[model samples]
Target: MQKLKSKANAKANANVKNSAITTNKRLYTERQKSHFLVHSVACLGTEVHLAACPLEFNKGNSSTGACEDGMPAVVSCVAGPLYTHNVALKKKLKVSKNVRLKGGTHTAEGRVEVMRGGKWGTVCDDRWNLQSASVVCRELGFGSAKEALTGARMGQGVGPIHMNEVQCTGQERSIWSCHYKNITEEDCMHTEDASVRCNTPYMGYEKTVRIGGGRSRYEGRVEVLQALPNGTQRWGLLCGDGWSTKEAMVVCRQLGLGYANHGLKETWYWDSSNVTDMVWSGVKCTGSEMSLTQCQRHKVFNCQKAVARFSAGVICSETASDLVLNATLVQQSVYIEDRPLHMLYCAAEEDCLSKTAAQANWPYGHRRLLRFSSQIHNVGRADFRPKLGRHSWVWHACHGHYHSMDIFTHYDILSVNGTKMAEGHKASFCLEDSECQEGISKRYECANFGEQGITVGCWDLYRHDIDCQWIDITDVKPGNYILQVVINPNQEVSEMDYTNNAMKCSCKYDGHRIWVHNCHIGDAFSDEVERKFEKYPGQFNNQIMN
Candidate 1:
């Protein structure tokens, strides 16, 4: 087995050594049995070919006379593109308009939405067919239609129904070029939104991109291999002028990383990689692109922060906590309570009640509270922990616990048009592994100054009986509203996914009683099933989209 492994490694090493010899891709050379020692003064000092450099090795007892920077000595010529592993790279994608994919886990699949009258709208599944879907696939530069999905298979789209009953011979340049019906309100609904899965050619784009100068593979400065018209290539940097989450999302996705924990604009701290030049600038993405090259960028590299230190960087993660609320728990444990203000002194000190409670005839009158149980589950690949350390946690005498974050979760009531009616925030004083999966021991507990975090496959539940677990609905009018519970609302903590963080339920309150229904996490139901999500779309949120 050892001999076989050694043979395998030797073969791999030969490929790398040959790559170095046939191309001027790498300069930091170390002696390997498979590598030929080479000396190049002109290639190292002056910007010239290796052939122009001296081909002699100085006679020396010490190792430092002929070879500088520990480079081995030989006589040979090497030339080619940067890091060309005898493979060809695909061309960069051009920005597309009129039609684009959205809400897909990756770029190749998404609901078949179209543009009309300067507004985006969905295509109905009345006659959704693969032939028509193939037209969209070709229009977007992909190979062909893998599948035609209907019944809002991608997810519910919010907009006008644009087209229906589409017919295509599959040779059209665009889906719009195919025979399709213009949408009308009476003809279709979002529930019948059409979607498509496309066959995308393997571009090996990830091989041409990398993160450099980090402590681990999970982070560093952004670098991309750029090819020239002459066929030569070089590793280049990305201009950091407006780089952030959306751009980082595409990058992490392209790199096969889970998600972006932090997208940094400047990477002076990780200034180690020798790659140079700001090859791309003004890069924009909708968070659905499968690769960074698929995102939009300036026609020419135009960046004020052209220096290397100001280049884009990213901290990615293969595993992160995904916080999801138990919508069913919220619905089952919701109720209205009228408690006298005198019994709420501790709650008042913690600012659990709304401002109206402050002006209420304290000790004499009662305030109405809408309470519910919130069971937040860490249904991701990593543990759910606060951003700050315990040393920074704030202690509250009223709650007898240390608050890991000032605001960890939010409870809100919204009107029909999405206007905030009433709201309350949870000061997470005790984020612990309330319960864990089978065979997993608890790692975090709030009692006796224990650590704080929700273990993966575990859940941290806030019962309705807990303090500050209720929304002060004292001034809320008796009517229909949406009750939304968002954990990690401010994004103070990183997660595998955030779309599932906000759990909402429809509520109808009639002065005396309240009913909560249709409670679910975003994308959990379909006219709502889904696979991808972000805070904003077609706009910027710590990332440039336009």
Candidate 2:
């Protein structure tokens, strides 16, 4: 009986030991799966769903179902201490056009409006001051707030009072990042809407550069304030020689204007200021320099033409447009077309036909047209809107769209050496969405007086079959040549990168048929590729033909 009891006790102990082993394995598996989920959630931030994290059961078990149990596996996650901060780092706050200033004459001044939940609202002036206002100005890409006006000095804003008692260190990227009190019923009203006048470079550094004796603020004689060796400041004219867009850009930048459209060498009509002492001469700039003092200059006490009429001038713009061509599309879309001369009236009017057509023998002959499609894109952050207001857009009865700009894109057939042989261009292109990527919708259309512009992430396509989409190559001899397309040729708008605005293609035309190859973005390729592209195999022509 004693031996039987010992065996019974030993059997009982063995059974308990087996159960303990199974429980321990299951616990180990659960712990591993939980750890994996937590790691995935931490890496991917709040966008990850806990259940979606990858896991495996019985992964290291010898048998397929060794870790299987009647109970289901469960995991509970407690966000780690670093989880909140990690999530914030993973997500970026989008800066929208929700915050805007209104009621001021210029874009840099106005009453403040904060867009909240799809509704525009106002900010109370309770604690609105220069620091808080500076945050708004900087967010809009301007300098800082010059004056924080109270009592709706610019004008009253409507809608909900979104914030009050706002505070800022004047360095926040957006107003939403600044601390502010949520609006309450007793907090404020539209009459207390905050207003601000941003501190533009024009107002702060007026002594540095100034425009005078022109019809508008945009056009004027350029004058610089020079500090004499004796510490006295004197305003004088800039010598017109070597004055070009590069020097004008520095002046516009110093004045807070967007860009320089034209740098006038002789502002005879704008010489109303009559301050004829030429102090700055041979002013040369690389277009990226910040101010006139930073540019290379020759100080001169006298000039041969020391008259205010010969002073340099600039036409400043609030913004400049950028146009870029799709070289890939141009390469694949080349063809030859012959249209009747009578049907080329509009093309002739716009100078899209060859120079021979402009002679007295004009519409009597048909010309061989080198036709191709053009895909113009505006990759700048801002929309490439027309410089003129709606009133100035010309009505084009042929294209059934209003022409906003007189010169938009230039098409030129050049010699291998750069001499222009044949030229054609599109005037007043109707900006619209030819196509867009996923999640982007077309904003501008040419129909029914619709707003015209290439919105961000949109493109404008001029098909090869469209009228005037050709270079009149009828009189050209067959040879190797270069095809160049320039957008925004007049620099009517501002762009982040003007270097990428042109595209080129290598062409071999035998009079009857043309072969276009080796097309590329103007500034996209490396130096090695460019050298290889311009290289000739057997013979090289040093002479340029036009």
Candidate 3:
């Protein structure tokens, strides 16, 4: 029984030792290896090879990794110094002539044979970025070389070698293994083959000159300087004055900068000799409306700041495109014509002007037909009294006499409580005063007992009492106001004191329509015209008064 137990212990010890050995082999085994070689540089090992395969696509679970179902594996060569497994593999890859492979076949007309198919077969060369090929050689257990080969099917099948443009990522098995079409050729030009390593971040140290300046005319090339993220570009140039309708030649180098936002980019352009390369690089602006050829980088910025030129300034915003010349005034020569006097009285015309100006042109004056008939020659430095009709209350005053009086009979007084009527042996005198100033005029007494002392108050009124409506008093601001009233035909009377009373004191009924002789007395002819325009009432329309 002791011997049996000893045998079981010995067996357990052996099994344990064997398990340890198996685990050590699995963990310490070297990872898959890859080789890469440039003309002179070469590196090999798990780190170099495994990393060559885009882990994103090639993993242990991948069919290519397991070599299952005959699925092809992707070979990427991100960095240059690319190479392939066997010389036979070289024939299995397609290449872009623009991108010289370290040791590979030359591409003729952009098509190369890769692979050993009996008849030439076409390989798709899409999505073949150069960086990818660098990885491909690294993954294929090949030393790093310069470029990658990508003609699938060994580049030896019949029919057209479709040869879609090869944008081979060197990491790919072959250039012909790409999947896109219409691939652009990276010509060995400075603009086409721009080295990303040299593109410095913009720090605003370069002198930014707008293509155009104060001058409106243009006659050269306009180009962009910086490359923007959104393909929108800005350009600058030099132009001269009067370039309103002229055409400017603006060159757009569409290499790095492709399609960008529709309206997000503000581009400034002009014509100048300094701009040689027309590539739209870092020529992005904010608020520029003009297109490349049509845009003028510089213009008169502030219209009011005469001759202020627009210079190198970043476009502020889209709204800033339309530069405003705030409050710019053009001084037009005022040709004061010595107009002759016509038959219309200056006072009478002023009334019409006042009424028309009240609504249509209160702040400004309205001129309809101002044809002066009298051609009064300008007697140089001459002093002459203006006609009595032309004199407003500011100039005219008459002393009452024995038979007549200085009276305002038909005068349209906005208010008479402030006016003084002095009686004399001949007539009564109406003092010029406003409603607020009426009490002071009492010192001038009635000169004659026969002259009646009449006082009346005038206020703006609507045509019908029912027409009166209540509006928010807050809505009514304090300002000049006009009132219109229509007197009933049956309630009108008339008098003939033409000159003394230009406005009608009483309404006269001619027919069915009441003849409102001169009810519409304008504020222009009155001394208290400004005072009468105190609080702004509202709008009113009347047949008798305006």
TM-score of each: 0.55, 0.51, 0.15
**CA-lDDT, candidates in order:** 0.74, 0.71, 0.24
Ranking by lDDT: 1, 2, 3
User: Could you tell me how far off, in angstroms, the CA of residue 188 lies in candidate 1 after the best superposition?
Assistant: 36
lDDT score, candidate 2: 0.71
What candidate 1 gets wrong by more than 4 Å, as runs, is 1-200, 207-209, 223-247, 265-268, 272-286, 293-312, 342-351, 355-364, 528-546
**How much is 152 displaced in model 1, in angstroms?**
24
Error of 2 at 395 (Å): 4.0
Find the 10 residues in a row with the least total lDDT in model 3: 319-328
Instruction: Sort the candidates on TM-score, descending order.
Output: 1, 2, 3
lDDT of 3 by residue, 394-504 (tens): 322222222122321111112123221111010112221112113323222224322222112111111111101111111122322222211111111111000111111
lDDT of 1: 0.74
lDDT: the better of candidates 2 and 3: 2
Q: lDDT score of model 3?
A: 0.24
